[model samples]
Each structure stands twice: as C-alpha cells, then as structure tokens.
Target: MSESAQQIGEKSQVILHFDLKLNDGSAVDSTRVNNKPAKMVMGDGSLTPNFEKCLLGLSVGDKKAFSINANDAFGMPNPDNIYHVDRTKFASDAELKEGMIMGFAQPDGSEVPGIIRSVAGHSVTVDFNHPLAGQDVIFDVEIIDVK
Candidate 1:
C-alpha cells in the first residue's frame, strides 16, 4: 500500500474481504469462501451505522477484527416479529417443520424469510426476526482498496 492511499470515510468506495463469525468463533459468512472481495460505498445504507463506524479511517491493506454486541449487531429479537398464521395458508404440498425457513410474499411484492417456530393442529408460528438476532458477532476485515 502506498503511503498516500485513500482511507475509508464518508462516501468513500471500498473493496475488502471480510469474515463474519459468531462470538463462539463459528464462521457465519465470509468473502474468502469464493475469493471475491466485497465492494461498498460508505454511508450507503448497506451497513449499519455502528458497523460502518468500525471501518472509518481504515486504509488499504489494513486488517482489523472487531466485536459488536448483540443489540448493535443484528439486534435483539422482537416479539412482534413472531406471528401465528393459519396452517391452511401454507401450500398443501409444503411440509411444515420446525426450523424451516420459508419466504412469504409482502404487500410490496418483495419476499421476506420467516422461520417456522412451531406447528400445531391449526396454526403455525413463524418468526420473522433475523436469524442472528440476539447474538454477538465478530467481523474480520482486510481492506483491499479505498477510494
């Protein structure tokens, strides 16, 4: 890296490789899996403000590992995110099972993934909360470039 290499800041375009891991050191995701680094512009809403703060002032070729608390990471699960729907709403051919993730259509035509929490006689409980909610995480990153 050059001494004058750009540092990551507001609106700066950055390219980097990163690994997302749980507090237990279990890997959740990583750019290294396919050897394709991620590219993003700072403050573009692709990252949470706290997550972006971790990248501030980092320069090319810099490597960092940071841990974020549960609330600051994916956030704590919300009770409102859990909903009970009629079993008939599901496809007749669908085999509903605990821990199954299914996509539900939204009013805007987009899809949101919901995890089946429980299946009863006539109702199914689905949790729309993020899978990693309430979990602390570690982010390991290597800055490839910042411009």
Candidate 2:
C-alpha cells in the first residue's frame, strides 16, 4: 500500500506532530516546538486508549484536534495519593514551596515525583497524582506517516 494510503490502525507505526493543551488554551507540550515529530506503535500502551482512538482511520497528512475528558485522559486525581510527611524528612537546606515538584524515594528504590501541596508548622502535604490529572486536555495532531 502507498504511504499516503495507509491509515492508522491497531498495529500501525505512526509518525506525527502533536500539540497538547489544556481546556483553557494553555500549552502543555508540542512536538512542533523542537521541529521533531514523535513516532509510536499503535496499541503499544504508549498513548492512552482514548487518545489512540482519535487517530484510528486517519491517513498521512490528516490533521485533527480532539478533546478528552479528565477520566479518559490522565485520569481523575485520587485522594489516596495525597500524603502528609514530617517536615524533618526533607533536607534542611531544601526549600519547600507549594507547586514544587520533588522526587521521593520509594521502598522499591524507584523514585516517584510528588508535588508539594502545602507546608505547615512541622508537616508537609505532598500529592503523588500525575500533574495533569483531573484536567481535560486538547490534542492537535498532524499525521506525517503510517507504516
């Protein structure tokens, strides 16, 4: 099949430029900014199922913009992901501020990033939810290739 005739499918390899934005029009990420497009194999778990659904049946040169809800996108924030830690757990020299992202070591030795939600007298609130959790997102995509 001709490259231009190939459509995005469950097993197709796709190359595309994409812009991710929030509902309020704030840009989250864009492949176009660096002049480099992204490549991915469909159904490989790289893109969310709902996001991939938007690309199905699209051929090269196709451009589309779609919106995904919070639950379907990054997912809704889980209240259990929030934790309160003693302020002493943080380095004495480290400045803790709301909205600051910091990496915390897990029991398995892998590091997970958490956002500082607040700092009280001797306690700190951190949230481990994905940064975009609970927010609707807009995806703008231009298909460059499908193989």
Candidate with top TM-score is 1
Write one digit per residue (lDDT tens) for candidate 2, span 1-147. Answer: 864459888899999999999999999999999989999999999898999999999999999999999999999999999999999999999999999999999999999999999999999999999999999999999999999
Cα lDDT of model 1 overall?
A: 0.93
Report how far off residue 49 is in candidate 1 (Å): 0.8
Pick out the ten consecutive residues of candidate 1 with the lowest summed lDDT.
Answer: 1-10
lDDT of 1 by residue, 1-147 (tens): 555558887888999999999988999999999999999999888888988999998998899999999999999999999999999999899999999999999999999999999999999999999998999999899999898
- RMSD per candidate (Å) reads 1.5, 1.6
Q: How close is candidate 1 to the true structure, as a TM-score?
A: 0.94
Name model 1 segments beyond 4 Å from true.
1-5
Model 2 segments beyond 4 Å from truth?
3-5
lDDT of 2 at 100: 99
